[model samples]
Target chain A: MVSEFRIRTETESNMAKQSGSNKSRLYVPEPPFRPGDTPDYSHISVPAAHSPVRPDPLCDADETRDHATSLIRVMRFNGETQGDWVPGISPEIKRTALRDIALTRAMDERMFTMQRQGKMSFYMKSTGEEAVSVGHSLALQDTDMIFPTYRQQGILINRGASMKEMMCQCLSNSGDPLDGKSIPVLYSFKKHGFFSISGNLGTQLIQGVGWAMASAYKNSDEIASVFTGEGATAEGDFHYALNFASTYRAPCIINVVNNQWAISSFQGIAAGEGETFAARGTGYGLATLRVDGNDVLAVYAATEWAAERARRGGGATLIEHFTYRKSGHSTSDDPSKYRPESEPDVWPFGDPLERLKTHLILIGEWDEERHVELLESCKKQVRETYKSAEAMGNLSGETRVNDFTMFEQVYEHALPHLDEQKRMFAQERD
Target chain B: MPQMNMIEAIRDALDVKMSQDSDVLVFGEDVGYFGGVFRATAGLQETHGLHRCFDTPISEGGIVGIAIGMAANGLRPVAEIQFADYIYPAYDQIASEAARLRYRSNGDFTAPITIRTPVGGGIYGGTTHSQSPEALFTHIAGLKTIIPSNPYDAKGMLIDAIEDNDPVLFLEPKRLYNGPFYGDPHAPAKTWRGHELGEVPSGHYTVPIGEARKISKGGDVTILAYGTMVWVAQKVAEDMGLEADILDLRSLLPLDIEAIEKSVKKTGRCVILHEATRTSGFGAELAAQVQERCFYALEAPIQRVTGWDTPYPHAQEWAYFPGPKRVGNALRSVMEG
Candidate 1:
């Protein structure tokens, strides 16, 4: 039975004393906590309810206390075995997910080869940040919006964007859906709410806030999730996006994939200790989580919780998926110069795919032959997609058709400048 | 016709348009229940309900971000910034997200949104409320910036802005609101003034974007101005005894250069007046374009009367904005030269 009662703080007068379990105050950590080991991720699981909203920046003590106490729940990935089997992630599905990741990895690998081969201009690999993006995107409602950085093809593949479509985009081919936007692969499914990725850092988070806020204003259950790197957290856009999401209770999930490195800068030296990326969300009175990005289950759970909270209007959630980039920052940067290899070896708990395979085997759900077949099939599919995409033709060469019309779709009636540029391009020599 | 001032004209434009479309919303601090600090949105929330009308946090960044998102997702949101000076914090969202979403998305997404805020100085609002930052927005692509000198176009142009499939920054001239909502920003309405703009077309109609209206047609000289400066130019035109044809530029971006060129070519003389600092004012570009395109039409150099190079002053604001007397002096000097 629920009882109506009030609780007064120890600072209040004794005569105004109140009782009950309300004294079990929780601790909410401030933002930018260190990623490595020490953080009390305990949080008061407030049963999702539409309680009276106390006006913020002037909220009551209870709200402040709630905000202060809600931090990441560090579910240690000590090769654990008790989590749910994420219904529907059958061996076939896992094979598909693996195939998708391999396709993304293959694309990243080949794009670099193409750049070096002087076929394409540039490339950025989604090498190690796959599980968080793929796992989280698959958990979202179909109608939800997706804002991502340049390395989230795993997200697009999982969202059902065909590999041929993505290859067309990366190649800037005439058949590219966004018409040679020269953007990364994931933005191919824009109608599916996957916003185009930006090379400029920390912008998609703000875009996510915009999408989520619009959802709230329109009374829709849809949520918007944005992907960023740990390096981007230092930007003003990150804080600006967070403050907006928390203050308005917008349904946006921020996934800061901490790859432990940002191009040449070690992600370690980017920000000091005790200030994890998840801590950044807590400063704005929102729920947050720091998960083992290598553990698919952990990334899945954190994103699942965040998705539900956003759809249920529990406001926003920030998730930091602790992982490693595993490759050079891009085809252009040399990691060996700054990497110092000591850090990678020191932090290795091994790859996410390997860990998941082990977890599956220990539970008697996976076997060696099945895993081998799965790997071979994934490789086969990646090879096939690349071959077909390669057959589709030139992305950098002169336009073969009126395909430059891709730029024409931006305005309804031709805007004068772009119109002139579009026309000028239309008449240019082959 | 009900007599209304500039603030009511702005609020009425929002109210009537909102009533017609569920997608149109009005949001800003104190705008929901309190009707806004300027009371421009008075009685709107009660009329439209909370979804289409509401107050946001004291975050200009949040306000613009949310609006861009809504616009991208198919909502025509008209967000208000309390003061022009406060828009700096939100400049990122406006410039980066709202302005570029359409272009960056390669036409897959567009921020068909409107940002409304009061600008210009004449009232003693010091540094904060008195700013003319149109040039800042014009420099950013994928954005359509506009300002209205009267309520007739204020309603019509605002409607067009809400309907356009791109982001628009609609700046309201606060000092102009002290009088009629859509009357000449520089003169009281005479029966025959702008008969072409008669009765605001009664029902829903859009004032074409990037077009300028010849508010007062005279052959001697063409005085180009917009927002509050338009009104000042008219008053100065009346005082200088010059046959001035003042063009009220409705849309500043995609800027109705045709109208400016057409007028200048016909008159062979021009004086541009604005309230922004002399450096890179919107008028500077207009003058440059006029000089380039209508180079041979000039009998006199294009004279610009504007706010000094310094930031908006805290005192003698009337002196700061080239009022009728100052504008008159500029017109006289240009004609004499």
Candidate 2:
């Protein structure tokens, strides 16, 4: 059968040659810097901070077409605030933002250590992309719903969710709100307006739009904010969410946290080659903004702008937070195998935490002594929270999730089959 | 009571539910202005206004995903997939997001969305339009799969589904949209105008989900079926002069196992039927359940009368469809045993 198929293919090839048809070739996108390559960002155009003009929240989507390609940055490198995008808040607010960002980093560090120590199954760290989640959380109202991926645990921390509860979730202990049903780091806090985190990527984008649509349909001022990585923009759900948000004018902020990597695959593989990820929103007629995610001020200002637009019924805004992933994708990933270790250090957008800290110090609201004190306080708080969470029970401990509880929430009312199965399980246990 | 087809009954259910509860919104591709290609949502947009019942872009994932979000936000959304065959695009959203939302969140959030889509293969829709994908949903833990055979059950069960707190996949058999199909295509198509099951009430009513309705009671053999296959089983039993206890399983997931066990134990024989492909179809689950529960009773091995393993072919549709002949053969074989 194989030889006969080969002969037919040869005949077809001859016919194609006679017809003068060109042979089709497949093209796969390759990232510029690989494992051993010396990474360079000189080819990337880093515009002056705050160069992109901030448009009116209610401005026409077409007026912001250039914003998709241009970068929106609020803080300059020398700890100076620049341009119209700067969120002119008091020093106190900046200090709070810095504290939240630092605490998020500190929590990520501790949870990552716990996973490595065999206390939890896995972990994902938003090491350098803190501004994207913390800034947005600060900008949006606590009432507005948030649909977040796993990496945005910073949102919960900034929303004042219990550090102990968050740690317990990571530990998959008895105190875990999900009863250890979900994997480690996939947290769900409804009271904090944080949607349950799904490990499956790209599904929450449309749900966010739908929530926003429901809010609008009910004439509620509360909007929704959703986040995904740059790679998930290729998922059909992302495009579908964009189209629905634009058509219905759903009051939502669609954020693409373009941290430049999805696991090992680079942004180019998700069709982020010639155009920006924010540019993909333009085709859906959404107001789009590409902001320097490392700039916490820019992140906050952009999220506030989008939230205001959504509240005033100006419709959805797609904001691409351009940043870099400093750590490996997750506990399971090893970035050294795919990309150069030097890439994170040479990333055009510097660390979000350092940038915010520098801005605070340059403005005379903070100093090296206070920074050290704050870091120590954050580490101590995380350590205490981890201790409290570990007391409830860790994944490796005996006080784990009750196996019989698995049959409890499958439905609101118990069915006969589930009841029978539960009885069987109880019998076996007894 | 008024005579209504399955489509009209479904529309009436949506209309009634929308009127009763302002939080219940209906939207899907072409379901707003056009009232759906199947017309199951006709007049809903005009009556409920655009915000309550609106059209969406042609994106199945978006449709179901948006429904999940809406449900999470305390709105009971009834979204329609144009056809069950087109539901694959939204499978991830349904299986991963909608089904697991409540469980994953530990009851912090719930997806009370009703996804209504026409299913089955008698309309010559061939591969793309003809499909019975209920088994796929039945395999999922959190989703409630309901397939109603007639207009009364369709309307009542749909209302029940929308009111339920969990996600429900309401699979409407398209072949029985306007009438009853008793497995004979050539025997002039019958309308639901005069049928007893078509006499649906105009106002609010609900046929409880997770409960099966015994269409006929007999002693020889027990037939388990749902949707279009229910009527086909009834016709086959009558034609073969077999004393068959036909049970219409309205809900597939939270199945009516008690009713099945009772009838199977009494009859001492069982025949499962569905329009889906034979391999790993819902019939397989039914047969397995019956065997597991009724193994002590001396009886013939359960028979499954279902569509062929091949895709629903356009040219050889009858060959692929498990018609009355196939169902009758199963019944005769079980009776002989």
Candidate 3:
């Protein structure tokens, strides 16, 4: 039926061309499925596991051109691991990965509920794209810097950032380290090697490249990793980052989380129609890979490969994490209004957390009973952390950030004008 | 001491800092092998090697963004935007990222980057090449805006800016690159050979940001100007035979309100001048600051001499420029009231 419709549309288009029509019209891309329609991702191609062979970490960028088009999946849907891309990490690490992914989802759920309850102003969930951050974080050294978008909270989670502090930031309470200066979830953890999150999309890509350049200039062993959504690839900073990374051979890894949706607009709006996002890096003469983001082993192996290449001064790599956003863009969005209500259930890439758990169980590293117990413990931990963070303050509570902090941190030292303005502001309060 | 033009002085400053601090980097479009379009970064790449002084792609957003990252990573990067008019493309990086990095990160990270760009008119480069965007940067917090009108201040302030812990927008007046302009386009070109302010001291010296220089002292009226307009104001006061107290505001954001108040209170009148457009220009801020600090001392309403609120036109550049004639009229008007 789909082929017949395609043939009929092509025939009509060809007839219109033959009728001497020279009118030019603007073309806007529309998604494959809309509200009330059945979301059928079966039309989309999903290659089998271990289909594309992994290249050597030090291979020339041109050698990875084929890899950019094919998927580097390690775990099959049946929970059987079979591929060179499989990262044979220890069983303990596999269990830890599963726990971290589960905890990230649990925390996301709790914070989202808090926002809906008016306890916080906003929240963004990583949802089905957990492995993109957790796997990458675990693969890279703890000292390596990470410039992330708002959605990569899993990086901080895997880095052992205090859940109370993260919750306090989200609640914008007195304990919020940012002092209510930043939007909720826009975290900055210097101690954890996580760069401050900038709400402006794609600005951090170039910064990561710059950081890598600085590392190389100083002859340091550390490399930088940066992440942005597929939607933000259209931003000029992304291209600039790739240009500099390839030109100077900066030691860095650039990850584009292609979750198939960018809020109300789909990935096609970002020029994801005919070409893959990973292919964008191939044009810049950088090694590029497309991995199954839901498969934790694949994400870990790809990130490890990229990190090894970067640390060895072999240049940068761009990895596209093919997955699906299984939730609304943010607390303020309603995905059902634009997309099918069953879209998340029908997504081709299954839940990242569930897949990792299944793979662990298949390898005799985890079981159904332990998975349930881990899920409960994660929820309990989130609840207890929220309680402690709530005691400090919340958006709806009487406790608030100190008003005086508003006049601080404008510069390293307070200038005369800022001093005068602070005095005036104090006087007004008095 | 050496007699240097603004461009040479700026280059000398970069060279001095690069020699002093190994972490100091100089880069921008055409700044490496070509020595920059205006020659402001001439001969630095050869002296410092390609690693320290290199060329980047023509991406202002990328240039500033990467500079911010480098700054956070313990490098004092001095990135140049070839022209001030081309800075809008990177405004987001400058205003949103650089300006807010220190504040948003709660002092955990800071972008101590110095963005040096050529500004102001009289070069006849038209809308794309000529602009005075000091006001645009002055409006942003966590940013220190500086515009030097002479060779000595240019070198000293650029050095200070590179060392400062905050992001500094060093706007070098292209019109005063070789010699100071006194608002006369048709006058024979001048050089900095014998000018008193052109004798820049070699090596290290700090002029301090947020401080104003009293170019010429008087008690009749206070004239506030910056960049090339400093010379225009001095020329207007001399040509009109008025003993005006002209203050060259080297810094705009952390304005030397003390100097402004003292001058305005002593003179009882004030006139603000700039080359940027009239509406919401830095002149407006000067006027407001003057009145707020010296409101009771103010004898007449503050007067402003500025370019018209229009896109800088190629032809009729003189009319668009707030020249000596317009400044003279403003000075006379303020004195009369």
Candidate 4:
């Protein structure tokens, strides 16, 4: 019955990802009790494969091996000691996180400024909720894949991605690594292990699981991490990815940075319980964790643990970091209309950088003089970088914004009529 | 020279191409091990190994998305949708990812992916399992749409689809998958080239994408059809004793309007037929094109004997499809006018 249909392939990106591996056959056992072809469920025929693949381990370091603990383990790991106010992690990683956090925050502020000045069309900020994205991204191995929602650009920011490169991409310049194939928010950097970012709200979650399953089957030991807001967890891909990851033990770490809002809708509207998004993972029989998203140390620890667990073939873990967006959803939004003015003006409340600064001060690892010195130098450097990028000229000089005819990437070999279309473009260009 | 049916020819083409290029892979549901649901890729998994030929999850979007990823990185992938009816679930990926890959990437990356599926219905596939959704894809600028009427063309067109750089939609007529009867396989291996005339190549060859096939030469009436309807139109012409020039459209977008005009110019009359619903069907496009180009050469108005604007009912499939009898009946009406 499976042999009664055919797949039409010609032209473009209709290819499926398969590695060079000989695993178990798709094992289609004969259906013995053949109920008369009456449709069960939405005349939508789901091809059956009852057999599952066994999870395989990866070659790793002793630290990575011992770190085969889920996000929840990391969340609970020093929870008692966390209140003791001792700073965890090396001095260097902390400063680096602090620096990345500051840069991304500045980038957003500048982006909004540019939007107000009409330099670009649109931009989404990583302000306030920086640590979950900026901090956790640093924990990933170079080979690990990250699928970021718009706000998660901070993940790229934290990965040493250049300010100039980010500016060029948003400007859609020729220097943009995405080569104008991407829209502003939906971006992909194949070299950075970033799969194509999707504009469809919850779609990348499923794609992350699929890539992880493929990686697991290939024994690559590479985990796929995808970002979404607390609100996006309500989408089907969240539950679908979690269930698939748990059932197959695919190397996927699902992160929901509970930034408390998806655009204008409050996170509470997404779920009645208001429990951390990570706790939702437990109902699906997988490991889960909820952490202070503002705390860079917490985000890093959770990510490090989840990555190692995935590398060890222990399956997926869900991490929900509690954070807040200090800026609007994008450059065009006004958070003031939605956000209340007052907050508990204390050291431990809603501020990711402040918590780290407090811990640093308590441990005597960081000094106020050093923070002031770094802030002055970093802000100057950021301002200079933006000036240099702006000097490269707008998109019209850097790249042709009108270059829209692009069908060649759909397929490797050219189709006949499309050749004609290309000829037309060549003529127009000439 | 080797001639075969559409399904067997597709398998032979996959085998030949897979053997030729280390990069070419074939996969989808049931495509591995058991071959495709329509057997278009039978024996590929055993012959090519799992990497080059394998089954994927039931997630159609995943199937196409991964295909896009693989193609973007550099691998020629041939993915199958079990049926055209089921392509909607994966529609966004094809439209947003596969088709737009090059345009969006600004030529830095190319998807170079081929999507193969069995489309159209005359077999008792009912509504859900059978549909000619090619129009949905052909309407998309970045896609190339193809439908083969015979084994030789099926093999040639599919290989063309696999080789072409842009996304191609290869539609195999399931009703014609085994060929000319109530429950008979529309395209059995024995009658692979049953509808196709002339010698077929044994080596790697392409029939050229976006080219139409002229099956019969006549001067009185031009019968424009595709997939199983090409053979149906030919059979009807034979039975009706009408000298109908039949054009088998191998490609839809970048449509061979020249071929249609040449036939209609001499024949002075035109008729279009297909199993898809009449409203907004491929026939509608053909009728519109023929009228635009061949209006002055008209002996009569362009006629379309297509499936009525209704679902492909389980009981009345024969009535729904433009069979030989229906084409013959419609041919007389157009010729007389």
Which 10 consecutive positions of candidate 3 chain A have the poorest summed lDDT? A1-10
> For residues B34-121, what per-residue lDDT tens digits would candidate 2 score against the true structure?
8899988888889989888888888899999999999999999999999999999999999999999889988888999999999998
lDDT of 4 by residue, A1-430 (tens): 1111111222112233333576333432221112233212223222222111111223322222212221221122122223221235687777788777777777777766765776656778777788888777888886788867788777777766677867767766555666555766566666677666667666667657756766765667678897778787887556656766666677878888877667766665576432446667766666565555776776776777678778887777777776677777887776555544332121122466665666666667788898887677777876788777666545434454446435445444565557767787889889
Task: Candidate 2: list runs displaced more than 4 Å.
Answer: A1-25
Task: State residue A322's C-alpha deviation in candidate 2, in Å.
Answer: 0.7
TM-score of each: 0.84, 0.96, 0.97, 0.78
* lDDT tens digits, residue span B83-180, model 3: 99999989999999999999998998999999999998898878887789888899999999998989999999999999999999999999999998
Measured against the native two-chain assembly using Cα atoms, what DockQ does each of the candidate structures obtain, in the order listed? Answer: 0.48, 0.77, 0.85, 0.17
Per-residue lDDT tens digits of candidate 3, residues A143-169?
Answer: 899999988998999999999999999
How large is the interface RMSD of each prediction?
Answer: 2.3, 0.7, 0.7, 3.9
Models ranked on TM-score: 3, 2, 1, 4
| Per-chain TM-score of candidate 3, chain B | 0.99
Candidate 3 DockQ, CA atoms: 0.85
Which candidate do you rate higher for lDDT, 1 or 2?
2
Question: By the TM-score metric, which is better: model 2 or model 3?
Answer: 3
| Local lDDT at A366 for model 2 | 95
* Winner by TM-score between candidate 4 and candidate 2: 2
Candidate 1's DockQ is 0.48
Docking class of 3: high
Q: What ranking emerges by lDDT with the best candidate at the front? A: 3, 2, 1, 4
CA lDDT of each candidate? 0.71, 0.90, 0.90, 0.68
